[model samples]
Target: MSDCILEMRGITKEFPGVKALNNVHLRVKAGEIHALCGENGAGKSTLMKVLSGVYPHGTYTGDILYQGNVCRFKNIKQSEEAGIVIIHQELALVPQLSIAENLFLGNEQAQKGVIDWRKTKLETLELMKKVGLAEPADTLVSQIGVGKQQLVEIAKALAKKVRLLILDEPTAALNEDDSENLLNLLLELKKQGITSIMISHKLNEITKIADSITVLRDGQTIETLDVQGGELTENRIIKGMVGRELQNRYPERHAEIGEVIFEVKEWNVHHPLRPDRKVVSDANLSVRKGEIAGIAGLMGSGRTELAMSIFGKSYGKNISGTLIKDGRQLNIRHAGDAIQNGIVYVTEDRKGNGLILMDNIKGNITLSKLNKVASGLVMDERREKHEAERFRRKLNIKTPDIYQTTGNLSGGNQQKVMLSKWIFAEPDILILDEPTRGIDVGAKYEIYGIINQLAEEGKAVIIISSELPELLGMCDRIYTMCEGELTAEFSKEDASQETLMKYMTNRIKKGGEAYADTGANG
Candidate 1:
């Protein structure tokens, strides 16, 4: 018997003005963790969709052999029946449903069109235990954190008797601890003889867990490398994914930092839902013109809360803050006021809160400031197209034209569009939260270059990132946040990953002084 459990030959898929996949091939051995690596829009997700029946059998020309038999699946149901299941980046669980209800949504434990609640709960518990999830079966999906919710998804897959499991960017939204747990679970599942395929942009995680890796670029197969051979490294994988050796992960920048351009003093924000709970407290930070400042903290450390609250109180309740721009205190009441005062915030949740996915690139790019491309109450389509085209070229957004739908573009392109929108607003202070999250190394390099260019243009940029190395590489000054308080501050010359992490995890007591003085007014 052959060891190969799955093989895709000569797969070709296309759409209007786009050849998403062209003559792609993939082979996955039985009971081995196979990783699919590529830059954004490199046909990774499209190939998976074709195999899982999202595009159906006839929509694409391909040969799929599963378990020594040719499989022509016309829908996801047929694929699932054949023991092939795909979990998307955006989880499919219903937030309002209970754990048990979500697990057996389509495949219920029932008799005579009536559900057996007792049997469902018992089986749910068994599945939960298998995935190391300790939550009760009656618990609502929304009640659990993202990590537990991911486990619920896996338990659901196990319930279907899944033989070949596929996951797309599983840990993109998870923190360090949750990501570690999920990767460990995958290793455990491999021990149980389950075949898995994981698609991820995280090169570090891929190198750690993948038994074999297949690199794809520009909608075609590059090469498959054996991890056991002891020759495969992150640099080698990068060569295959981007078709060249990237000498530096971060682009070089000549920072010309000037006098203080923006300052936030004694900023405090309470939770909107729970008014008594403070989300950000006694924060003091300053950014100089032509400087890139960074906020380094672990997940749930109030970095985003602080940025949002500072940006016209978009988040939190009972916000009290002093915003000084160029030595003048401003009273900003809303997002519009912030924009008018030349302050813009680029949200981390780009898909959820940043862009209108349905709108085209031209609309999204010019959406932030309509006055730039409008006369009185009427929009100038020609001027709008000109501005959008200019930014698309400026950012090197990979697309056929400015009329393409924003949702159809890749993750990296979507982020560029979001940046273009804010840049069009002509902001003096830019707060970018997770600017390079979920993007490949090539895209990250481009984004860092863009940030450098913005700073070169004399904008005061504040970055909030989960990746410590990114902050260390790009920021001229870095501040550490812990439990809603500014714990410490360090200059780029004095900061390292180890030093930043120490202060990030340092818990600050209430009414206590910061570990280090920020050297700014409070």
Candidate 2:
């Protein structure tokens, strides 16, 4: 127990055109929760993968020391066998399978190649009890919410006899109550003598649980800090992560708010899967030109659904909404109508819904309006390439040419491509959904600049984000939502995460006492 449980010396990993990790060093002691902190794509995940053998030994230049001895793990199974398990941010659980089945997926309770269902159920129940999850063991993973699915992942780790567990952004999607529950569970695991490594962007959560903190920047490890005994402050952790004193995470912007350019009146959208259930309830919101209005809410809070429903009725059914643009009522029947009406939605998912990964950079940029690239029917290749090239340089897509496939680019570049697609469509009102999600600090800054430029040009910008700090920073005004209802409105001067969250959470219970995340918005 006195020895270091895990150590990686001079670990390095490289991808095409990028060095994912560069000569990094990290160590975790027995029963210690060592937090790995960095912005997105800062090699925190890459270094962990190297230690866990997601990248085979021969692929990276490093030595992994486990439990006072050097270990060569060729695969994830071998690492798990050595009492190591990694729970990725994107959970690997099978949605269709029962929790018990997922827990013992590879290592099942079987004799003569037949599973012992009775024994599996009992074992799963015990594991669930350890994690304090109240769900039945036989419930399908898809039927439960994200928070419960996370517990199942932990249970799976426990089933493998894990000694050191790695959790990547475990609570990124969880609500406040769920996030607190997960953090408490980690402390409980620590009490049981289990060591853990957590990679997260939420500095608040990290400060609450981490024993020691390791900061990584651009594939290199910053000096590790011992944060026990009230030494860990948000200021210190942020300085280490960003490598500079941030006067304000949100950039300075004096609002030049004017008349509302876009407004949604009596908007109600039913659930796409279940039309009888309302996803957005008579939501009324407005964005003024040259002003950034933010929508802040937890996941499944109908923020995205509201945006999608308003953007050409692409999201929900039984949609009863009146959209007004430039002080005139506009009927948006479909996505194309939404675009033609100068309304565009940048989806939260870049790889899944936003961009054509297989297409070249130019193709993606011009995909929204090919008719403009031609006189009548045929797409003029020269004009298409020129349009792609222009936005590629304008948005700083970082590719040599517009011919590059979007899939080959980095996450930030892919996001930029997604943005470029919407910008090329020439929409007057742009709704960005999680625009800076999974992007690094540098990229986020660039994105902020782009957003400012968009607003400065007198376009209406509506930002939807789970990160409260971002809304406080980028948005001139903020709107709070909970349980599919629009609850509170805030001005930047009077807004903070605490004030905003209060309204966001308080709205959960039917018209209960109104509170703000920080305080009253002046």
Candidate 3:
């Protein structure tokens, strides 16, 4: 008689040195959107993995009841057969495959073990229509944008006849418009009687869509709030997740800004693959010592491209620019050169381009500056450990030890390790791209404090973020980019979300001209 479609009771999962989940309980109603919220390492993902059979039944002590029947799944396939499917944050689609091919990868529409092309295409179209994806079945997944890719993922889940869908950080990488569309699609799915459990760090989205919310903290369930009961609020959720009153989302900082120490003038870059297409155009910006500068833009507005191209021409082809540091022209050709000249870029793609996940924390922390922990071509293990342990404590990394593999650490801890690596390089100018992209509010506040500390130490810091509130809160000055052009600049006092968004979406036309006239120097 209970309306719960899925119930996980007394789940306890442990690893070699960490108890990832302890007595965690979750219940998803028949056709409601349930949100799972917590800090970085709070066992949200681990519990979901157990439910989807990634950890398997025997690997953990738990009881899973699906539709009032005891379910013991041995693997992902068994769970899928039982109508439970999990779509991970890192999408599982093959880039080279067509949309139809990726959708029916393992669960193919076939006759005698061979694919039925006509039937496959027809089903693919139907599935796409359900998720509001209008892409052709023959179109390569690589050819579509990230928004379209997410739709493909959903359509794939639909193909499996998913009764209970679990999504991990679904909108973490999506832009605003794409995130809205995806959230709307989930509502549509709910109307069709599909139950969903969403694990996300975006509290606003949770408050907007989740019917029931379960908060987890440090491997244990804290509390669950009902949206219909008016018990769901961002502040209340934050209090549960962090076990305290957050007070202020951004830390207080007193900046002692000095003269401009770094400047890029008349910068232009062409796309790496398409030489005729420009990615960054006539961009001019400057950062002073003890100042946190921010670049605001929509996705594909060339924010990341500008940052990467400046960090020793690591991106784009036919790059033409003048880099000035402390009133002197500097020529930098590569990342090593940029580092040598006291400039470092912490990449937005932490997993793909920043950290070596398989390596230990100590290895990743000392990777960027091995010589600092080296004794004449030999690595000093003691020094490396000492350095890594220092940063771990300084950043409150929440790891068992520095010897733990980076892959096992949570998203926030992995990001801290990435920052520690670049911080160890002893750079005078630090550029962070999407520094808090997938991080929770507590983790984001900690990162903001770290940036404040860097500014206090007289290091010029530049942040590139899609979240306007983050930039408004943390930056001493903000720059808006639109269509590969630096459109406008505003001091901290003048920068508001509305104004920044207007420039970000290219609503104001004269801002670009004003920026060209004054530049960052003005």
Candidate 2 structure, TM-score to reference? 0.90
lDDT digits (tens) for residues 3-97 of candidate 1: 99999999999988899899999999999999999999999999999999999999889799999899899999999999999999989999999
lDDT by residue (210-258, candidate 2, tens digit) is 9999999878999798988666777787777778866555556666767
Q: State model 1's lDDT.
A: 0.93
Off by over 4 Å in 3: 507-512, 516-522
Ranking by TM-score: 3, 1, 2
The local lDDT score (0 to 100) that residue 200 gets in candidate 2 is 81
Ranking by lDDT: 1, 3, 2
Task: Give the TM-score of each candidate.
Answer: 0.97, 0.90, 0.98
Which RMSD does model 2 reach against the true structure? 3.4
Give the winner by TM-score: 3
Measured on C-alpha atoms, candidate 2 has an lDDT of: 0.86
- For residue 522, give model 2's deviation from the true position in Å: 14
Clashing pairs in 1: none
lDDT of each: 0.93, 0.86, 0.92
lDDT of 3 by residue, 163-231 (tens): 999999999988899999999999999999999999999999989988999999999999888987866
- TM-score of the candidate numbered 1? 0.97
